[model samples]
Target: MDILVCVKRVPDTSTNEIEVNDAGTDIERDDLVYSINEWDNYAVEEALQIVDRVGGSVTVAAVGDDESDEVLRRAMAMGVENAMLLSGDAFAGLDGRGVATVLQAAAKTKGIDLILTGAQADDGCAQVGGMLAAMLDQPFASLVNMIEVESDKTLKIGREVEGGEQEISRIELPCVLSIQTGINEPRYVGVRGIRKVASVEIPTMDAAALGLTAEALAPQVERLDYFTPEVGAGAEMLEGSTEEMVAKLIEMLQAKGGMK
Candidate 1:
């Protein structure tokens, strides 16, 4: 199967009370905890299960600084065969397109047959998987919730569509898929598993090694600023006891034509 799963390390939203930085360009990161992106966990687990059945290797890759090694190692602790860190000065401040370009290069070198990524990262930009596929000139599918390998070269995939429906299609090998969560329950990585791979080395690839120039890695979109949206003034609070509040809520809904 020779699957490559792309993962990311993001702020642990559950633990961190995210606040805007003084500069308003990004979140306040100091003293914040980081972990694998929740959606990426599902993607990695799906890749592992696929390899377990089809007999091949599952490699997890991340685009970040050395600190990202933690997430990669965690993926290793979850039974991934190999991990690679795509990192370098040039990779810094890259946007979604640049990231896809880096992964496209890595995919070529690894002789990968299938590439999997989370439907979206913490950034909520669900563009990488499709962009990587386009850059590689391979078939692509997003929001993939089910995958059934029909043969060495073909796969039957199920995707979620509008109206809460599932769309099933056959996609050939050498393709990329953005895996949706709930596809599988990701396995837990305990302290023992983390310690087991603690000493294992993970390879790192830089822009130069990937034949990428600084200009090539440059981000097209620039963020001018980051500010919290102004709170809008709107509704009235319902008062009185529970029954009265319920009645008031129904009255408002009916007044707004929200109820029959």
Candidate 2:
């Protein structure tokens, strides 16, 4: 049950307002607090749980610059046995496919029994798990919430489908699983774990070492613009006495498709 969980570092947008500075292509990230992506936490915990039951190691990997090392240490604090940082200037501005190519190349060389990652990054652009699986030429599942490793090369997995329904199926191993949140509760890193992480030295691998050429790493799609969505014209506020407010609200609602 040697498991490799791919993780990411993303800005903590919940606490701070994001400002676009790179001509709407990216955010001004220097001042933002960064952490392990929320979805990756679930994936890491699930890997740890499975490895705990089956007896193996869990390695967490991240793709980012120097500051991204913090999140890898954080994952080690969560009990991952090892950490890998896939980084290089060549990795900058990589699209989802480019990233999946890097992860696939690295994983192929290092090797693992199962691969797990969040269904999507907090950046909200891609569902990359399937992309990695496709590149690896293995069975792929997305939005997966449950997993049962029936054997070394077999997995019975469950994924969310339509209308709150769950679809479960069995697939062969050496496959990638895109974890959906709620699969399991992610454990909080305590002081002891944090202290351990502080003393750990995670390895760094340049994308070039992964055998990725600059041309191959180029993004497939280009961003035309990155502007904050405009507020809807119909959104308005009513300020008045309670009776007047109620009347105005009712009128507005009636004008729309609400109660009269």
Candidate 3:
């Protein structure tokens, strides 16, 4: 089995550098530090585990600018056999559909037998995996917590559904899966692996290489501006007797429209 795990480089949410610009349409990446999207690390780990058990190869793929190579190398250092970067100036400003189009083309070139991705990227759009699956015309399952490869052609999986219920699904191979973060704990790169793949070059592909054009990959949805939400101080507490405090709390809630 050839497992292709899609990864992404995103601004570290903890850095507090992700902010909307004055226009309120897109995040400003200036002065931001980048890391592999946290959830995608779990997906990569899951792929590595599968290949370890099943005697296959794992390839990590990403769509981004030249800077994305660092994240791909990180995955390679963690034991991925190959890393691919689908990037170009034309790929800039792509939305989910454009991303899926490029990724689908790349996956086809790799002759992938299985596709895995984080249920959602931490930028939090939460739509790429499903969109990619749709573009590939493959069956897909989301929120997967556990996966069992029954054979070269089948998978038995466990997913979490609403109301805390666990659903078991038997999906065919050549499908896509969006793994939930808690599906497995991602492992750290060891010194040996890190040093071994540190200088490994990540192969790059572009829209033109994939026989795609900018118009075809252009975003259906456009970002018009970027802005952050306004911040304000918390409410003042009124010190009083228990009964009086309750009355005051109700008054505050009512004033804030929390109470009808």
Candidate 4:
């Protein structure tokens, strides 16, 4: 059950505001702290958990520049067998599809049997898993919560859907699965563990190494414009007793066509 897990470094915005950069096409990342995207951590951990059960290795990969190695080291520290950096200056400003393009090239060299990724990046464009599946011409399932790799080279998986229901299926291996969180609790890496692997080098492959050219890797989608929204007035507070509030609410609703 050799696994390849793809992770991304996303801004840790839980404690910080995401400010649009002066260029407006993206955020100001220079001063922001980055961490493995929350869902992707689950993907990494899920891969580790699977291989731990069936006896195999988990290779982690990421698409980014040199600064991207932080998350890869963290994944290795969590006990991944190896890490690869799919990087190039040409990869800058690429969209999710472009990222998938590079990742597919790198993945081909790794001899992966199972591929895992978060259902969606925390930064929120959920396009990579499906796109990569298409690029590799492999079967894909998204939002999977449970997995059972069978002896016959197929997997029985349970996918999460709305209203707490689950969809189950049996799919062949060499498939792509976009993992959903709560599938498993990600492990915690102590500072010592991180530091122990801190100096370990992760091999990187640039676009050329992956047989990619600048033209083949350009973003298919273009960002036309970006703007910071003007601050608006605060909401009106309805005051008084419950009855008064209900009456006021009814009046407003009637005025707004929400009620007759």
Top-scoring candidate (TM-score): 1
Clashes of each: 0, 1, 7, 0
TM-score of each: 0.94, 0.90, 0.88, 0.92
* Residue lDDT tens for model 4, 28-64: 7687888888889999999988887788899999998
lDDT tens readout by residue for model 1, 152-254: 9999999999999999999999899999999999998999999999999899999989998988888998878878898899879889999999999998899
Off by over 4 Å in 4: 229-233, 257-260
In terms of lDDT, the poorest run of 10 residues in model 2 is 22-31
List per-prediction Cα lDDT, in the order shown: 0.94, 0.87, 0.88, 0.89
Model 1 off-target regions past 4 Å?
A: 233-246
Q: Of the pair 2 and 3, which is ahead by lDDT?
A: 3
Winning model by lDDT: 1
Q: Where's the lowest-lDDT run of ten residues in candidate 3?
A: 16-25
Q: Which stretches of candidate 3 lie over 4 Å from their true place?
A: 190-192, 231-260
- How many pairs of residues in model 4 come into backbone collision? 0
Native-to-model Cα distance after best TM-score fit, residue 177 in candidate 1, in Å: 0.3
lDDT (Cα, 0-100) at 110 in candidate 2: 70
RMSD of each: 1.7, 2.5, 2.9, 2.0
Give the Cα-based TM-score of candidate 4 against the true structure.
Answer: 0.92
* Cα displacement (Å) at residue 41, model 4: 0.6
Better of 1 and 3 by TM-score: 1
TM-score of model number 3: 0.88
* Candidate 3 per-residue C-alpha lDDT over 111-221 given as tens digits, one digit per residue, 9 for 90 to 100: 898999888886578788898899988899999999999998899999999999999999998899998988888888777876787787778998879989878897998
